[model samples]
Target: MNLWRRLSGRSRALALTSAGVLVAGGLVTLPVTAAQAATQCSVDYVTNDWPGGFTANLTIKNLGDPLSSWTLGFTFPNSGQKVVNGWSAIWSQSGQNVTAKNESYNGSLASGASTSIGFNGSWTSSNPKPTQFTLNGTVCNGGTPPTTAPPTTAPPTTAPPTTAPPTTAPPTSPPPGQKVDNPYAGAKGYVNPEWKAKAEGEPGGSRVSNNPTAVWLDRIAAINGTPNSSSNGSMGLRDHLDAALAQGAGYIQIVIYNLPGRDCAALASNGELGPNDLNRYKAEYIDPIAAIQGDAKYRNLRIINIIEIDSLPNLVTNTSGQAGGTAMCDTVKANGAYVNGVGYALAKLGALGNVYNYVDAAHHGWIGWDTNLVPTIQIIKQAATASGSTVRNVHGFIVNTANYSALTEPYIKITDQVNGQTVRQSKWIDWNQYVDELTFAQAFRQQAISNGFDSGIGMLIDTSRNGWGGTARPTGPGATTSVDTYVNGGRIDRRIHAGNWCNQSGAGLGERPRANPATGIDAYVWVKPPGESDGSSKEIPNNEGKGFDRMCDPTYTGNGRNGNSMSGALPNAPISGAWFSAQFQELMRNAYPPLS
Candidate 1:
């Protein structure tokens, strides 16, 4: 996920060659002949060098015709430089000249397509540029955009290894001979059989195909983890826990959703418990889960506890909006349940050594504004204090849970509706001004540390289906009163209303969840597994007993992503946990980074 940039010592940075800009080292450009120049294909070779090691990124552009196969040739200018490890290409070095052939899966280049290969190498005297790139025997010509054709397009790479890495899932339930130090490794998570069953048979169709919306392979079939919800049934949490323990799971991901004033301001997730039922939440809800998790029998298994989602953030929004006006949060504020509940969950659960508690921080769309962030952290701090639990009881914050906020910054940004200038670009960094979840997570880490939490506290992002890239994603801020229209790329998120908070269309799987994707980001997780609906679309409900939210109504389309609209749910979706086959297939087909 880290972009390629230069290192300090004798580094060469590439500038836009259009202005005839020269960098620290000699300019590296590709020359093409007149006939071949029609296409004007280009290649970008970049490197990040350190003292002894360096990284090379090789990008191939198809400005001309799509090719079934292509090979690239480049030579090292430094004599002592040698190749170490590489991905997406087969590399061979003879003297200072090196040749890289495309791998079986990626040789084909689509028109205007570009695929990249990365390698780690060792350098002695200096890391010089690999000048004069040639693709398929034709010399590539480099041009800095805005080119007639875009230079980069990332499609799904290849099928993920069906077998999870040995560190995560082993064949049977007993603890492995060596326990994985980091319980969440290689991004494997539990799957709900019910969702798979819905997709594996009758109405359920292909897990991988190009069938438009008919029945394509969704990543939900591959990378999602089940969240045990209290609304599903009394036994849901216990059953999910039992299954996880039975699998010899190194880590079990649990979502504690039954806050007394659950989803405080939202309708879809309104729990059976009311604002005044703090006792019920602590005694009946928190006590039982804590007892089960803290029990010594399952001491070795790590419990990844995602504390109340949409709970604390609502308090901020509610409290801030009701400033000295009619108090909308009277009941919640009276019982002190929201903050107290999270604290109780943490104190009780943190008493156990294995449970890593991630209290929800909401998504950037909700808390990115400075007005909302201050109170959210204050509530978290008060809650941690009220439980008589120190910051140690909390692990960091989690973002974009069951929400469709953009994962990376820059995918969406806010421009000034008043001024023509971009107001909040992704490049800007502040606690409350982040444009996306990645920056918010990083900012949250700094806040948590400042608020007495450990420096090592890390964040988890629910990438379950936030990968809104490829064709299904929107593209601009063009012709809209909205400030972030350009960042979101025109058409806004397809959710019916901004606050509808139910099943949403046009959402896809985000970056494959991985540990340490960036600093302060603990792991990218599928907290809200795809295929399972966010909430039921219609009142024509099932046995799950979750109340109907009009946001799920397919025809209830509205505009914008904030408080302006209240009914933006997608149509044809099933209840919260039930499989919505169409969404499943759609997610697989439209996955960001493309599902392999």
Candidate 2:
């Protein structure tokens, strides 16, 4: 079977947040592929260790038909093995035998998709690898896959003599606190049905236009509402979390984006909060928000707090193209609101055991520029320090949050833009360099470790719209001269301009929320809800606290900054956080695995 068949059916396998237009919850699923023949997936495992403690990274491929749920089991040869913690699954071990089952947020699998799971373990004397593995009770092929392309010689694993009864235990509902002790076994994700109902109810929306009716329909939802004064200082955030718990959701993913001078480099997304209002940010913003998150009623629900988008990245690399050399972000940073505000929020929110905090590590485009990564490291460290806490208070950091950087840019080539150089084959990255989110994230994670962060700090990438699959992908690595085309089409992402942070065109839902796509990556989350507008492109008067940049103006596509006469603007989309009917249709249509 060929893995690239992008079409459903025996594809080799792997298997595998945010608001509205800002409760679109994180519990997301995608349109399913019709059942295909049973596929025997392959497993790739790696480990990094120090002393007795070690982290195991497993990439579980789905070779069979689409799986709604899955379970993985392996037995260590040595009795000294112990699973200390795990993420993305309900991990449990008995002696040397270990089992990891899918958690609520990540159960579905497309034919070609893969999901990841990881655990930390401690071993005495020697740590031996487990040779036998089974997924969903079916032992993995543990050999090279079969291919239609005739092999010149016999492919590996042609003769299989060994067999074992598949483990009978099926994927089960996670107990109220399955991994409370397992630092990595994480909280269950709660998708807000209210947002799902809203999306489905919208006029001319996805439910009416998308194909296949229903397969993985539950994954799409948005929480675009901001916490302006009318909302009682984040009462919206509180109420949504409450509703999630009411619906039996064990984990709630929340975005705290209303920062002062938000999105400073962009025309759109300027926040309602002022740059100088540190007092209000703390007293009215973080304090009350912390109260609700800290409340005993919500303690049962794991709160994944995504603190402030477009806040820190600006301090280092401001994408806004204000006519002046200085962007408003400079002002925001000067005021110290973005840094201090995030620090205070981290201190308050991280104090909760159930609340896992992820500060923003802007997408590669914004922060991956030359020296900006250093500043990102500095700023994150500053946030942790300002909070009067160590970096350990932060569960991890997130990348591409509310941004449209592709998960991987397979065709990015180094160019001296000032010298007018275009694409070249000098760089052929399989996604472990500066070109894509994956590499940037890996580098950032390593940099964090070097800078005194705990080894366990993980990452989350906002993949809501970075998929850009199928025909949308450019045909050649060095195909086009237009920089955007070169970077977007030839490369992985489809954004017209990296700085154009508004609702980007041709973007689609990326990898579903699975644990540990990469070593440091916790999960690929839809941090920005699909179907919501980045912000209004029309020159509409804004009473709401959101920013109104011409960048949103489909007609105003200047250089992607300052909403100038740049030529690559998307069509006029709806206001930020508003239900964007047409865009919603497009996202579902162009969905990576082909959403319904």
Candidate 3:
């Protein structure tokens, strides 16, 4: 079947924390395609040793739907494997001959697919050999008799597969209590100061620059504190991660909050993991983060792992009941290891090692959802801390306040109240609204750092509706600005992922949006892209065409559905005039030379 048709029955995937707009307590169930036939699949994992005196393990699973949840586990072999560095999944080992275990997944896999998992372990001797393997229950190579006969005479093969794809070197998992720099570092881009003025010139534009503050940039280099590069897209080499990195950005007070995914809320409506999404995160989100960290490109990139807490633990059911079932408080105890198993998987793959985790502080209005914000944070924090990370290494947690509407007076007032009373630093980024991207960004940075943080705060936007490139119309009433003015400002801190890159895609590279040249914003990020369509195909049916309406079609309005349809489609549509991508690009390129 074709991609869309194949995905027809699939539900949209949810992030660990993607939630309803500003609601904290209620579960987030993102919209998705009607259910398709469930694919059939199974997995088997094995543990082995390497010549480097370390323990190793492997997982082989039939891709009944190209599953991405394959992870191998191994005992420490006497704690021999110290787990100095790793990735692909969270892991841990005990004993002198350290053994490792398989990690978990949160995305997708198609049918009739198979993937393997392996890790390096260290031993006191020149080389140590592992002697165990487990697949859910059945055993594979290490010595245990296979439950079933193999095609070959050998009961189990101890040797590495000759066709084994080159192992992706894992990143160093920081010792329990150290704070590593964020992944986005030295993101080479020019920050224009005259962005706001230029925005007004766009169709149905407002004086965005004149309002509060705006930040912009074009061609932001994805710096991971390592040598790895950003994932490529239809627009050539564009950095999706730069938006997240922009959050805790500044020369002296550098801090980083590694929040993955483009349209997490849109992704999470499904409330359960799909094979395709599970694999996507492994290959796209989590793995890429690990690779960058492993490469050590931006050593200064402080690592702060964020788990979006949109849906309840039990949104999806499994043999044990619904996955993540039970409240955060109850589940952690019952499934702490499994939860830790999840964390461990994340940790083993470079999650818990040095990176401290922060969960969604609140969903709607800082505690609006069914899941209690403060209480859930307490549970997740306790569970995460139980992993044995250091207090200093663990940074305080936070969440997006309001419905990406921090620019509104209500969000500002509430945030002002929280910061005034609490000594603890709390950060909430505004979804670039109003004309105050800089204002909120600067405030968040100060609060985060003052609370003993090493860096400032972040300001992320929801630009999928606008399609990042200058071609789309302004969905909101705020004015636009140049790239320069937006990036550098008195109160501005950093810019996290503003648009939904790849996911909830907008215009392609040729038609991508550009920041106003005069503003000189920090980075003109491709928050949205071509390949990954928005969760709800309602907006633009084929994921093609031009104009902001086509790019941000959450409401299927492009097909003529109006009113509430437009509610999800565009907040400020029926734009004054048609979108002119060429004009926008010309203005932006002149200011941001990399684009020029």
Give the candidate number with the greatest TM-score.
2
Q: Which ten residues in a row are the worst by lDDT in model 3?
A: 1-10
Candidate lDDT scores, in order, read 0.59, 0.59, 0.29
Write one digit per residue (lDDT tens) for candidate 3, span 271-379.
2223223343334444444443322223233333334333222222112332212343233244433233224323433322233333323222223222332344344
Model 2 off-target regions past 4 Å?
Answer: 1-187, 202-235, 319-327, 411-433, 475-489, 560-567
Kindly list the per-residue Cα lDDT of model 1 for residues 1-596, writing each as its tens digit. Answer: 11112242222323324322223255543332343344346765555455666556556677777889887777788898988645456778889877888766567888888775655577899877865666777555544233244334655689888985677642322321122224465534554444344546533233422111111111111112324432222235546556656765556677777777666554555666767888767655665566455433455566777888777766666653442211435567667888787787776665444567778888776777778776788888888767545575676678888887667644344434324545453222222376567777788778767867666677888886777666756554444444444433443344432344566667776777567778767788777766667776677544333567566666554333333454545577666666677787777666786765
lDDT of 2 by residue, 1-596 (tens): 00010010111122210110100111222222221112266665544444564446567777567889988888987888888655556789988899988866568977768765666567888765666567776556533333342234644766665797578964422222211322224435565454465467755444422211101100011121343422112235556777677767556677776666666666556666666877656555554555455444454576777777767767765534423234577787777777777777776665454567777888776667556787778887887877345465577888987677778765554542312643332222212236678888888888887887767678788887777765676656543555544454466565544555677777766776656567667777766667667777775565565556666777764652323444334576666666676776666666675564
RMSD of 1: 25.5
At residue 275, give the lDDT of candidate 2.
68
